[model samples]
Target: MPGLGEIIRESQIWKSIFRHPMPLDRRNRIVVMLTNFFLHLHPVSIKKQGIALSYTWCMGGVTFFLFLVETVTGVLLMFYYRPTVEWAYTDIQMLRDVHSLGILREIHRWGAHAMVITVWLHMYRVFLTGSYKPPREFNWVIGVFLLLLTLLLSFTGYLLPWDQLAVWAITVGSNMARATPILGHEGPGQQLLTLGGVDMITNASDARFALLGAREVGEETLNRFYILHCIAIPLAVALLLAIHFWRVRKDGGISGPL
Candidate 1:
């Protein structure tokens, strides 16, 4: 005569998947937290002030939420986008003007912008609260790398639209790599790098060349950026983010008072 909820909880399928009973008691709650993947990221206990809205501003959580939104919307956008020069711009136009889910692109765009801002704000908050001190210092460094990755994600995504502004902005941005000291042909120490008395660094072999995969930004540039935006950079970010969160839990949860 057990209830439906109880019957379901007792089923073999449920137990196999969950591996633990309902967290109705303290022991069960701890066991659940230890066993579950997502729940394991959080500490068993957190300071009251650590979670207070006024203290943390919840920027970190918001940044992570926006990243999730970007992932979903970006995936949806990929369905309608073609990275080739011929179809790239046209595909973007169709998404913006012709497709039923055109708004998905807009959402992804704004979410990227928001994620950048929130990550900066989150870093600022951590600095202001002295959260970057001591045992949390390593995690702070991780956060700094995360901030760079966030900006890289934005930069890589900017070109997917294939608009004039996007192309020009990337052109200007990528040009900065030409001044990369020893690695760039136009950089400071290029003349010093010689192989058998021949200058090794040139327009054809430099940091910018590596980035664009050619001397100029064209089909290859678009393809490279598309891969970075859709795959390589996201994978790196995801791996770093996993470490960042795990370090947070290990560093004694969120930063409390000094």
Candidate 2:
């Protein structure tokens, strides 16, 4: 006779969802991993040494966990947020006061900074162990991109509060783009853009202008940054993160000694 576990596995709901029994055996284990969405990020087997707390420091896993925290808190914060300049600061204030959702914002903000630190530490550990070699080379490149995206996610988010500090900070940060070689008004080689007595790369069309959406920071800048922080950049980062996780699994799990 079938065991109780087998009988439960045969139930309609279990069969429809799991389509397999608990991973009690090697084949079932592999099948369960391959079929599940979350489990697929992990290999069916990993180097035992790689999982040691001292060796790996668990930095990568911690970074991913913090990302999950930020994503969830960010979504919750969005429910009370308005991207418009008129309502932007007011909304954050409301979160702090009326809705008492300030903790969510605090968690999201600090978690972002913490994510940056953990990602750096994770890369450092990988480097120390020479894990960037051979089959992991492409994955290292993906990590580099993910690091950049993490910084960008932080940068775009800095402007969302729409306060004087946020505005001025982003203004100064955006102004640095004006020195981007030919693309910026004050950048090197900009002298070459005197074609037909018209400066092809003037302040009107320079990087800073494009970033702020005007000559100075204002509603448009806030709106643009909000879209980028809340939607575009996060979506891009999530896609890159998925690719990073998949690449980790494909490269034979976490790297360790050969």
Candidate 3:
């Protein structure tokens, strides 16, 4: 009879899962990467210069890795989190004191900060290397959106703890939205906005109010930020990230001088 290894290799389940043989040769390696959804995001072949640490800096990969880490740890933290004003602070306190889940929160918090730093470094590296030129310009725009999403995610999560620190931080942050030019009521041209003789923009209806879901940051704000951080922003980031990867392949893979 054939060996167990051969039997397993030839099994229908294995074939279905892998769709190709082990990449024992260059051709098979390319075939394997092209056939797999995850690996397919990367090109079948990469130039030495494209991957060289001194050239690319690898900050993009690090930022993406930190994003994934934050997502996983954030989901785990959600199990013990409550977004209500009454329960939010207590829940965080319990996680810190009783449940020993402080480590997970620490990872999420520190990972968020790290993601921000890595993303900026990645953008700076791209700029320094002139990777933003030509076909890579769209990818650079996508990277900018991703950076904004990272910041939004961090901002939304900041209020979940519902502590005095969190409250004051978010209050100050949201207040900054009032100066967002046309979208904000307190911006320069608020007097120009009138609908049927009534002002369309007001403190209660402006950007800050929309962000907080009320005049002040409270239970409603917590709930809104929870939904945004846990669902909406993450979904948008995932979709954009997929496109970002596909575009990298479409743009002839990672850019390098040679």
Candidate 4:
């Protein structure tokens, strides 16, 4: 037993593999306490009954479960999707036309809708519970941003089908971007485009250009939207999502009454 102990104690490989501190050691506490990046992310201990099933369940764990489900199903959908306009609409149609396509699409669509609802409810719960005071205020801001990103993600993806609804919805959604003020990207960029002799600045470079991938809503536009829908927006969302979770841990794992 002593020989075994020595081997375990001296094993650098073991230390590297098991980086987490020993569960109850005071020495481990000091190590965690001194680590800046992770130090403030967790309390030293928790009450035995603090995380009761009722308290935890009342919040939105189900919503997070839906997010994971969407992630898995989305990845599967990726395999069947191509970003080109020619293929994008077709792929979506195929999802419906094929035997299981209907099931997959509904699960993905409904899952997205449910995720939005659940996230909102989650924030509401946190607010009602008075969890956004002081140290957690910054995290609350981050959560709000995440909620917006989630909605944007849904909106941006809506146009992939190239159907009447998708086209019109994005057509309207993007028009709002056009009307935003100079600092909002309309005034300054628009004036610059006009000076450059781009007759239809909308055709040359604008919200439509960015969204459609070309001057107008043709093949190129769909392709661009597909890229944003599948890749760019998701990456941005994921990065912010990481920060959101990290801030939660840092802010003492949700606030309580002072």
Choose 1 or 4, whichever is better by TM-score: 1
The better-scoring model by TM-score among 2 and 3 is 3
Which is superior by lDDT, 1 or 4? 1
C-alpha RMSD of each candidate structure in angstroms: 2.0, 2.7, 2.1, 6.0
Error of 3 at 232 (Å): 0.8
lDDT string for model 2 (2-98, tens) is 9998788788978989877889899999999889987877777777787899999999999999989988999999999988888999999988888
Backbone steric clashes in candidate 3, count? 0
Query: By the lDDT metric, which is better: model 2 or model 4?
Result: 2
lDDT of 4 by residue, 13-107 (tens): 86775565553688777666555464554455665444665444444557657767777788888788776767877888888897475577779
Collision pairs in model 4:
212-221
> What is candidate 1's lDDT per residue for 117-211, written digit by digit as tens?
99999999999989999999999998999999999999989988889989999999999988899999889999999999999999899999999
lDDT at 201, model 4? 51
RMSD after Cα superposition, model 4: 6.0
Count of backbone collisions in candidate 1: 0
**Model 2 stretches astray by more than 4 angstroms:** 1-10, 23-31
Query: Total clashing residue pairs per candidate?
Result: 0, 0, 0, 1
Reference-based lDDT, each prediction: 0.91, 0.87, 0.89, 0.70
Question: What lDDT is obtained when candidate 1 is compared to the true structure?
Answer: 0.91
